[model samples]
Target chain A: NAGVTQTPKFQVLKTGQSMTLQCAQDMNHEYMSWYRQDPGMGLRLIHYSVGAGITDQGEVPNGYNVSRLNKREFSLRLESAAPSQTSVYFCASSAGGTGVSYEQYFGPGTRLTVT
Target chain B: LAKTTQPISMDSYEGQEVNITCSHNNIATNDYITWYQQFPSQGPRFIIQGYKTKVTNEVASLFIPADRKSSTLSLPRVSLSDTAVYYCLVGPDYGGATNKLIFGTGTLLAVQP
Candidate 1:
């Protein structure tokens, strides 16, 4: 059902360039999250949204911004991309906003490389 | 959030059962242990979750000890496609406060051909 979809599966940007990574879920989940995976670092959260119009900062929100305009979309934007921003970005959604044991469903991922 | 610790890697032959354990000594009373599997370049997918005892799904089984301090994910009759990184997560998950999963170096499972 294309549970979660991310746009621009791969991208390359020069330093100071700006770009947006889009995420959407057809599962109608209440919570959505953004994370970046770097070599040996595992995955770190970038930002999240509890519901439409409700957004919050995650462990690694620097150099990035997020918006939750509607129930189906949560997008991540890099204002001015840096070399450190190069990594594989993922988006996730969960029905767990209401329960204690909610499990997250993830998007395929967006691999971004900044030179 | 309770911090989690797991192995760096594991290896097993096809048709064998593989058990990967994770330790979360600081786990709170309300925290739950969850597991996810990830192939390279893909997002981690949820495998199973449990508060205590054992919970089994079609893909894997999760066993949480009585003390709630650790948990194990057991894959039965694993095949080549089962080779991936496994992550164990422990958190309160109250009001989405624990939404960000802080991943350690996940166990890289390599199933022999």
Candidate 2:
């Protein structure tokens, strides 16, 4: 399996600019998540999807939106970029089922800089 | 989800065993303790996980006490490459869908020669 893959390894956007971060997983996982990590800090969830067509807000869901068009794809959209949103973003997926281990597979993070 | 507390930083010499402990006082009955390791600019990788007692894998070992309030991640025979931030997460094991995982500022382990 290719595990999880994220697009645009790095991006820089100006204030009020909008962009979408792409996340894809080939593990056929039922759960997918988007997280942001600030320098020297742990990750905070932005959004998540339990399955296709289902999305939910996470701890820090403000300034962001998400969509799960299919089981293998989840996208994070930023309506208006802000400097505070400049951080490394990560996409992760996990198989969800009874008696299954809850280990998340993470993709290479996307580094975003909002000027 | 339960909050986790761990050391901010730890130092160890090469070839020595390193133990990083995380405290979760409000862990629920269905919650499991998991550990993840991350190097610079890379994604975090699963190291080990355990509910109670001990869980041993090829890479590391996870030890939880009977109360399951705290867990320790033991890395044996550490090397320079083992230097990274270690995260301890506690969350319920939902049967079909997992709730969000809260990642606090993890313990940064610096390995020295």
Candidate 3:
């Protein structure tokens, strides 16, 4: 299984430009999440999905949007890129149960640079 | 979601055991403490997790006290490869609207020879 895979390992966007970050998991997890990590800092959740066709805002969801059209795919979209949005983005999936089943599997991460 | 506090950085020598502790004063009854290790330019990986007592895995061990207010992650026989940022997260284990995981600044571990 691929666990979780993200597209475009690295991307550079200009001010006001928009882009979508794609995340897919073959582990058939019911929960998926998008997080951003700044230099020397831990990850902050941007958005998450409990299941297909369900998405919700997270701690830092102001500048982002998300969609989960299917159980295997979760996408994070930036409507207007800003320099502050420049950071490494990661996608994770979990089995969506209690206890140890909540262990999340992360993707390789995408490095975004907004100029 | 409970907030977690941990050391900013720690230094250790190779072959020595390293323990990183996290404090979560407002941990809820259903919340579980989990640890993740992040390397440079990579994604964070799960190390260990536990609610009470101890949880041992091949990579690390997680120890939680009776109160579940604080937890420790023990890494045995560390190497230079073990150098990374460790994050302690407290969240509910069940899936629902509150199934989000919050990450703090994390503790950076630097292993020396």
Candidate 4:
């Protein structure tokens, strides 16, 4: 099903530069999320969307913004990159329902380095 | 969100059984314990999950005691490929329309030949 896929597997940016990481899922999931993983740390949520056109902030939302324009696409944008943002970014999607718990499918992840 | 505590690293030999335990003393009644496995340079993958007692899947088994304050992930006959970071997560069992998962530092399991 191709599950979930992320774009720009690797990126390097100068401080204050802006970029966007793209995520797409073919599973027809209602929920999508963005997370960042630093060295020797667990993945932390950056932002999430309940559905198309409904976005919300997550645990680590600062310096990051997200938009879910359609059901299959969720994009994360960094307005101004900082050194702290240098980490691996992952995208996940889940089929949310009334009685179902969250079972997420993650993408390969994008490695970003902000100098 | 309930916080999870696990060992930073564990080492075992191939063909041996490895059991990694996690503690979530503050886990709420509605929260479920889930485990994820992640290889280097890859995203985390769901392994097993349970609320209480025992749950077994093809990949691994999740054992939760009566109190549910702690849980263990048992890997049978481990192999080098099974060496990875294991994350224990606690989240609402039925969050309904707004379910989100939080992850903590996972235990790194190294399987040697």
Best by TM-score: 4
Tens-digit lDDT string for candidate 1 (A44-102) = 88888889999988888889999999999999999999999999999989876522367
Residue A101 displacement (Å), model 4: 3.3
Q: Model 2 chain A: which ten-residue window has the lowest total lDDT?
A: A94-103
DockQ (C-alpha based) per candidate is 0.55, 0.52, 0.51, 0.53
Q: lDDT of all the models against the reference? A: 0.88, 0.90, 0.89, 0.90
What does candidate 3's lDDT look like per residue over B1-113, in tens digits?
Answer: 68889999999999999999999999999887889899998898888888899999899989899999899999999999999999998887676555667778899999999
TM-score of chain B of 1: 0.94
- Rank the candidate models, highest DockQ first: 1, 4, 2, 3
TM-score sort, best first:
4, 1, 2, 3
The candidate maximizing DockQ is: 1
Tens-digit lDDT track of model 4 for A48-73 = 88899998888899999999999999
lDDT at A84, model 2:
99
* Model 2 C-alpha lDDT versus the unseen true structure: 0.90
Show model 1 residue runs off by greater than 4 Å.
A98-100
TM-score list, all predictions: 0.95, 0.95, 0.93, 0.96
Q: List the residue pairs that clash in candidate 2.
A: none
Regions more than 4 Å wrong, model 3 = A97-101
Deviation in angstroms for A112 in model 4?
Answer: 0.2
lDDT, candidate 3, A10-103, per-residue tens: 9999999999999999998888889999987878888888899988777899989999999999999999999999999999988863223278
lDDT of 1 by residue, B6-42 (tens): 9999999999999999999999988888888999878
Q: Between candidates 3 and 4, name the one with more favorable DockQ.
A: 4
